[model samples]
Target chain A: MSFQPVKFYQTGTFTVGNRLLPPEERSVQAQTKRFNSINSGHRACQGCGEALGARYAVDAAMEAANGQLICANATGCLEVFSTPYPETSWQVPWIHSLFGNTAAVATGIAAALKVKQLKGERRDIRVVAQGGDGGTTDIGFGCLSGMFERNDDVLYICYDNGGYMNTGIQRSSATPPAARTATTLAVGDEPGNLFGQGKFVPAIAMAHEIPYVATATVADLRDLEAKVRRAMAIRGARYLHILVPCPLGWGTASHETIRIARLAKETGIFPVFEAEHGELKSVLAIRRPLPVEDYLKPQKRYAHLFAPKARLEVIARLQQLADRNIRRYGLLEGN
Target chain B: MLKQIEGSRAVAEAVALCRPEVICAYPISPQTHIVEALGEFVKDGTLAPCEFINVESEFAAMSVAIGSSAAGARTYTATASQGLLFMAEAVYNASGLGLPIVMTVANRAIGAPINIWNDHSDALSQRDSGWLQIFAETNQEALDLHIQAFRLAEELSLPIMVCMDGFILTHAYERVDMPTQAQVDAYLPKYEPRQVLDPAEPVSIGAMVGPEAFMEVRYLAHAKQMEALKLIPGYAAEFREVFGRDSGGLTHTYKADDAETMVVAMGSLLGTIKDVIDEMRAAGHKIGVLGITLFRPFPIAQVREALHGAQRVVVLEKSLAVGLGGILATNVRMALSALPIDVYTVVAGIGGRPITMRSLHALFREAERDDIDPVTFLDLNHDVVDKQLARERSTRRSGPAAEAILRDIGVVAAKVAQEVR
Candidate 1:
């Protein structure tokens, strides 16, 4: 991920303080007039990566669509916290159908807008569907795949927090290998989540050969916003998967959300990249590659592997998976 | 505009005439032909400005309809049996969100034995799903109800399921008075959504309602249906003014004005029941039939009024409540709870068992004599059932009962029955 450097200031870094750069080049969140799509005074936890990710992605989509946007949200932490009955945190046209039908709902909204547009009754109104990993990868997988296959005009954003954090951190299809969840307990010969169990939905989304597919993290707001803007620019099915860590679920510090996401990308465990119509387009190169332990050690879900005996073999296996991702996406500089 | 066509095609044409803006389809048995025709209509520009979405599953089909409908597009979809059950969650969501989406439920029996035949189990299972359910007695009624469905749904901001018997009505070829586009246009005006997903006036729908207001939110859904109970008759009358036919209402009565024995049923089975009633009336047995059109909202007052004059009412339904004999009969009993009328529950045509005129004549005669059982499974093969029950009692592992029954009947006999059909 590259941007033109502002000569006099340190604007090339991933921080939001790029005020010296031209207004158009600055991130949507940096703008004072950015659409606070997911507004304040909600129930999202402290340092909630999903909350940050949703705001960044939706605000960018709102900007890209010129405020002509409707969002269909899947039932998750995002929906539960944002809208509690008579009170709503969303300022834009939004709907939360069910946990597994957000993509299809977005497709319906897009289709409706298109028909209305054709009838000369409405203008260019784009749609975005969003959900958590549980909704996107497990229960909602069929609808997501259908939306992709039909090439429906929907930008589906999956806030991947690795488990069903909203429901007490149960195992989801996106839960990492050997990561403890309520359902996948750290016990027996193989503790935590079983190896080769969970799925990588971004790869599945890419397999659908959609118009756009991208993976981002809260650590890189610029990349996340840019990807969302790029997706909104496309007409057909597009997917943006963001690694949003959960403090309560991951057993990490409330303030470690961004740092953990940064470590995830830097360790090659979660390669931040973008793809266009099934072909790899660009990779966010790791400036300083770190070991998988640097990413996992802070989270108590993985504390079992470090405590009591320090399972070196398990750590080695997790490292191998990270190394595989690095080789697959060529994440490290000059790799 | 009268043509002899398959029931599904007539329905497809009727649905198209309503000018749905979005049609989400997932192929399920019986309802497949209707969507297939609608698909072609969209493909060939017959249904212009309409998006035909072939979704992955019944859940997506309903979910997509929910989205389009909430966005203020007149949306439609169809499913049956397992398909209906598969999309049960979304079905409730669409209604709970108050999206006025119309759907066709090609009524079929639910499975364990896995039969794909016509029954009322599918729609009856969703009786409390906060959607208006209207049963069609004939293919023409099925065709006519869909147009009224859109109008009624949009008018009240409620989802409706126009249930027609699968394979029986969906596959049957019949003459239907297909309404013209001009007539349908005059009848069902352009959809003006009550609440919509528009950027111009943004609103967050499907919010998480807590216990404090969840009951009120649910009560509103019930209120809407109660409101629908009043509005359905007017819509049907207006429909008649345009299309010149009486198609949909709470219930329709045939010869029940001064009759003693009243036979009550719904869907395609009404045609059969009505025919039996006609013969019994001619024989001076003073029998009549009540065809329940709107099953949901139960039409409690109307049902009580209609059956109040009768000495006894035999409720023949195509669905059973398994452990509790009759689904429709239970509701009918509730409707006539204050009256002294003996309501006999006759569960018939279950899993597509043939409800022959011969069997019905005997059943009606028995009911007239007040000698019928409280709950009767019409045309049940008692010998085979008894043999299976005996086998289960004697053997530790009694294999699958459905297969055992099939074997007891003999494969050759089953083959002969299939050939006869």
Candidate 2:
């Protein structure tokens, strides 16, 4: 086999597609025949990141599985908005069980498929479980961890939009420090969410030594699609944590969803990386490392840090945390 | 094949004969051995193509069953007491989604002081969860009901709980006529899921139903259970033809044709109650036993017809409603609400307290005389209860009622040690 150097385009920008890339190498969303697994007519709020993330992730998974895909969705914004009784936006076989059992449900589907395959009925049918932050890192955490620990044939995707957006912006374990949620109000001595609280589930998932673990943001559709495809290609348990920026929860404009997600990655606050068998494989190095303020300033959740005289110490603490992530993941190129 | 086996093992063998594609297991007392045997069967290739998942909790066990069941796999799991309560949410979800998943609730009492003995509290707690619940009176019945449960659940597209008393049946060894695989295959057909998650026929299941259709959806669930009330007997008859036994039905009567007093109960307590009824009959009392094999869908018409000929009815149940009286007795009252029958509620064997034949005989004799209280607690230690009540009345803080009672009975070592000191 001869080696071929494929030319890439718009590498520095958060663009998902380029005409220069071959059809085979192009992102699933950039293709005209992409499977809209989560079809249109959803009741998602304006600039709902979960909606975008679910569509991108599930469509890519559907493409990877060759349209043979079943989804077990947790009760959250994605489930409620996409499926409301007499109407549903799902174009694929989907089930919304409860708030916390999506992972176990997917495991069951995979187990069923395994038996079916053994009995020579079906072949290579895949299962993907999707959940929101509250459903993934909080209530659903036990089931999620159990799925991971069992190394069950499931691909669990967590659309981490910081907090519980559907339930009125309540604080969740994924809610970042100093982000104001309904429960973690912006008025206390330590305003907004506590610094030491909240969890980065991708790390916890990697700790399970699962086959694959990756983190993506909605800003980089190409990266998100690539991760989903890569996860689907592998067997056993895999996890993809996507940072979906919720405009309603973050108090940003509808159009700012993608931009905020981009800033989140560029600011080193959310390090984009992939792992296999508990070992770091790759990191999507920051193309233009911006200050953490660039990510926090646009969102009203963090408006408290900049208002009533600058809370320099709190801002510094957040910047230090981002710096720690950058240093830990080697997010800076040629570091 | 008549063989002496533990109830759990027999039930496990019965579940295997049904050819469950997925069996999720989480260890809880009285239900553990059943899953352990299932795990062995899967490991030893006795149950081929079956996936035995040792889940972390009962919640995951039931959730996995929901998934596999929805994916067109015949799924089964076993749980008890706190385990059932832990998986309560998924239990409701499984029934709501109308998945034909069968579960064995090794019935044990729910606890404040934590007792792991036999009772119906676990299964009765989920009476209204949309799943068809059937009580098994013996190890043979437990095995037979499980085989029938899979068929009934799949036909109705509903979940079914085969509730057998923990330890009493689950731990006891008894001679059971274990049916061959051919007999089971003849009775229970291969699982053909009514709705499945398939790429070819894509559909959204477990959708979020709002107020407009939520009521209708729930009513349809009720409609299915009512449908089950009609189908159960036919399946039981088929099972009898195939397995050569009369095990499951809405209710099984023992000498109740012309009886004046009908003592009704569910689960393994029926065995003791039947023994007591025979003794009472031998003593020239016109009392008989009506064992409720199927508890849910309440069997209103059957229960009414069974008890109508009697002058008075006594419902002996293993579960209590605490502030109210009896859970099963309440339903019994509903069944006889149209008639002018005196239905006495005898809440007995709570928290694994053994329901002895002696106590039951006396209770039935009192019931025959119409001299028993409307709601009676069989074999209750009134002394300990009165002491606890007096302590609660006199002291501002009763200091944990369960512990206080244990102390009153000198069951707790700390209190005994303090007394010794």
Candidate 3:
């Protein structure tokens, strides 16, 4: 297929499509265009991170697979917002799996595609499963692990935005320590999220020693796309965890979604790295390290810590955790 | 075709014959064997052209299935109890998106007390989830229902669940007349997904609907389910014509003609009830039984037409609602709301408790005498509860104040410190 130029409106109104430009220049969802993978009109809140992650991840996968990709999405903010009824934002072959079973569902899709391949009809089809942190970590952990163990030909993606944003920002296992979510209230001394709880599934995936496993941040589109491309190259089970910060759930400024995600990596709160078969292969080095407080203080979800005398000691502990992560991952080399 | 097979294996054969492109699931007890069988098929190549996904939970299982189906691939999965609860959100999504993914529910009891056995409660809880729900009475039916389920689901663009009694139908070995590949192919044609992922045309599957069309969109799904009420029987008839066995589509009745009393039930217990009815019939009792095959549509019209002639209709369901009898009883009451039949409700075999022929016979005798209560807990041991309560009270007086005692252990202090800020 020939490349189409993305259409831009001469008026700075942020409308993506216009009549004058060539159809190739039009946006993916433009009326004149046909390759709109993420269809028009979804229930996603304004500037939803999960939606952005989905659009980018799915479209990139579609392009990489030569437009022969099927997406199995977990039930979360993405599924609810995208397909409300007779409408959807997905332009490719998309499915809405349950919150916990995206990985499994994608595995099934890949299997089905393989069956077609055996029949001598080469469709060049690939499968991808996407979900929010809540669905990926807590509810669907077993299925995810099973996919890893079986090495099913699927690339499962988790858009980690800290909590269960769809169901009223409840605390999920991916929720950072001391973050205020609906279930983990901002009351009591520790205030907002429990300490030393929650599992880091990326590390667990490394233990399984699958073909590929990586972590990306929405802040770095190039890195995210690169990781997705690398994941697509592999045949066995693969996982890509993307740090897509939820503005509504995290109680942060909508535009700061990318900035907060960038800060998260710089602060060593959420590391960006890749591994293969139970071994740490590489870490996306941080040029300058920032204190974890910079990443935490801006979001109202973590605002509880700033108040009640700013909890300097707690901040110190969090900083210590970040420092430990840096040293453990060798996140920075030389001064 | 006539070989000894585990109930789970029988289900796998049926699922394979349906030729689902995607199989997504998390294995929960009683249902694990079915998934295990499917897993082996993926490995051995008995089931080809399928992606067997080992999902993290039932939630993911349903979610992945929805995505695959939306992408225009036939999908299937199985779960029970906790697994079903975990995937509840995806269940609603699959139906809302109109994906037509088929899920096999190995009916098991939910937990608090942590029991694993045959019960309709798990499947019953999701009755309103918009998936076409069918309850299987035997292992053969479990296998056959799965085949019919895929056909019905795809035809209506709706997800479906083939519910069967846990270990009873899932673990038992049975001689099922499996359909040959040619026969199956002829009966169930290849699935060409209605709304599939096509980059050439690029259309979205699940999109966000605004307030303007949200209600209407849901109404469309509701209408499809209502449409299945008619569509199911038509397809079932076609299946019978090809397969040579009548499934009765929604509800199956036995010896209801010229009978004054009828026992209504669902799931594997129907087999035992039928056996007991045979004995009762030979003994010269004017009694019969009606086994409910479909739960979601409730088969309200068929149920009413069948029960209208009977004087006393006994409803046996495996799920309870505290004071309002069983779920099926409530549905039957609503169906027969306009009629004058005396409906007796019995909540039996909950938490996988076995409903034996003796127990069923005794219950039927009670139903015949008009001595049966409107709501009866079939196999509850209340004495155990009374004994446990007495023991707990005796020990409580000797126990120290809750907080003071917890503090003395030093653990409470540590917890307090963590929260103290």
What is the docking quality class of candidate 2?
Answer: high
Task: Specify the poorest-scoring 10-residue window by lDDT in model 1 chain A.
Answer: A1-10
Which candidate achieves the best DockQ against the true structure?
Answer: 1
Best-performing candidate as measured by TM-score: 1
Kindly list the per-residue Cα lDDT of model 1 for residues A188-302, writing each as its tens digit: 8889998884489999999999999999999988889889988988889999999999999999999889889999999999999999999899999997889999999999999
Error of 1 at B229 (Å): 1.8
The candidate that achieves the highest lDDT relative to the unseen native structure: 1
Error of 3 at B325 (Å): 1.2
Which whole-number lDDT from 0 to 100 does residue B364 have in model 3?
88
Second chain alone, TM-score for each candidate: 0.98, 0.96, 0.91
Model 1 spans with C-alpha error above 4 angstroms? A1-16, B412-421
lDDT per residue for candidate 3 within A176-273, as digits (tens), equals: 88889899999986798888845899988988999899998876665677678788888998999999988899888888887788888889888888
Candidate 2 C-alpha lDDT tens digits along A1-335: 22344555566655533556666787787778989888888899989888998899999999999999999999989999998866799999999899999999999999999999899998779999999999999999999999999999999999999888888999998899988999999997999999884478999998999999999999888889999999999999999999999989999999889989999988899999999999889999898889998999999999999998689899899999899899989999622
